[model samples]
Target: MSRRRLPELTHHGDRLPAQEERERVDMLDGRVGVEERACRGLLDGRLGASVFLVRSPGVVDGRGELVACTPEACSRWVRAAAEYVIVVNDVSAELEAAHRRAASVPWWRYVAAQRAFRDWKTIARRYEEVTREAAEAYEPVAREIGRALAEMVEIAAQERARQQDETRRHRSVLAARAFWGWSEVTEAGRRAVYVFRHDVPRDDAPEGAAPEESPHVDLRGLRRAIVDLDLPDVRWDGAALAETERELAGIGFGRWWRDLFHEDFRTFTAPPPARGSSSGRSSPSGGTATGGTGGFSGGFSCGGGF
Candidate 1:
């Protein structure tokens, strides 16, 4: 038999209702906040699960009977896991970039050294601020994604139970036909089988049957890191800001301000060729802080192509 194509999924379009069609279009009207656009874009990338449904053996249940599942179920599992990983990496990258910006300036050492300085007192302050922002932006969305994943797991379990029941019911009807001395190839046996197809709830698994694996394992593991993130307790304090301003005015801030801008430009711009060097600026020692994504380097292999 020819395989059937499952329904196609759009990134963000399917999320809106018929009444909100205009609202989706209006998002490009230049009035949407940058933060909102960024969050939406991060959550709605070019990603989807498999498009075909095929049956295959899944994990063994508590009764040791290997459960069967639709291919889409496993595909969606991997997709949800991948999305969870991506959200965590995005938040980590944002926090790291903020730290780099603050630390790259020459005067950062001087400012960071003063523990009593409430304005930019601790280097931890930068991390705290960035983490809070990330949490506020992503916590709710991450929870929604986790909820979708748990629901998918439950659906798969329910479908497995239904299929198992159907198989048992068919077998029982065949047994009955045999006991009645009716050959399956005969007209009477075929009629019995047809009648049994419409039978409802005759072969449900008995009480204390095999239990399926817990869906919460994925939610509690590394896949659901965002849901378990330790959000910072930082908040805005006007008094601290006033103190920062007063401190800035007390020092020769004008010179330091110009140096800060210059340092930023130098740090970002490509270097000019070194004089009299044959091999053009022999790549800086220790490889010049390449800003690689080390956070996502391991343990992110999705079982299916996510």
Candidate 2:
């Protein structure tokens, strides 16, 4: 038996004709509306997130008919800038299905997942630029999928923290009201008192100023009430309360006032500094932590890995 040499694969420039490029671009444009619908479907779980290639670049034989070709040549063209060919069947239908499915999940969960998807897009774009090799396109896609998963988990964790914070704040507010006979006041006045106590001041006061002088309510009776109320176990030390008030004031009293007093206020707890990675995982203890693989999800998807 004699060994045989395989035919050389043509580069994208040679294989994909201008006419084909125009046709593919036109097809893609036509499919844009459907593609968007399909993407939404996948995000909403109405349609599974899977990549499919309906047509790949190829050539016609002398008989003037298209013919199947080897994967090697297809791979070459893909590397050489061949446009991805795909079809999104029933995108609108799928989106409707997804909308129905999404109704079962908590609205916040859906919103969190969407945010993660956005982050993943941003990270994907950067990954694509860094890894320009033809074989690496799938890597970025996989990374994006991973980011979406991680984001879901992170959102859940952050939600828990927020809930805890809200519980603590609620109790503290109740205690303050009880101790000061604040319930006797009108609802508006009671709210004002709570806002005055909880709202951190933004003036350039000395760092160690007394609580009363610091423009934040630091009544010992209020603190005792917060502890006695038997709220969820939150790390509500004097320092943390002060910091929270300061952060709230920095943003503006009116804007964050409602947020501070919201029933689910605890669910919006900020992640500790240690868990500040793009992946949404935090360090075991509270200290500086390095960025995790820069992955994101939701509307943030882009060209790179992080």
Expressed as tens digits, the lDDT of each residue in 1-306 for candidate 1 is 001111111222222111111122111121111111122222224322211111122321232212222334334433433343344345444544434444444454555423223322243355345534545554554444445445656878999999878755643343233111001111212111000011112132222222132122221131122212221110111222222224343322222222332211112122334366342212132111211211111111122110
Give lDDT tens digits, candidate 2, residues 1-306.
001111111111111122222233212211211110112122222332333221322332232212232344333333322232122222233333333343334445757545544444443344334333322553453343335445645877899999889866754563344212111111212211111233434232222224343233333443334334333321122233344444333332212323433211111233224334453322232211111211111121111111
TM-score of 1: 0.24
Mark the 10 consecutive residues where model 2 has the least summed lDDT. 29-38
Q: How much is the lDDT of residue 171 in candidate 1?
A: 39
Question: RMSD of model 2, in Å?
Answer: 25.8
Q: lDDT of model 1 at residue 126? A: 52
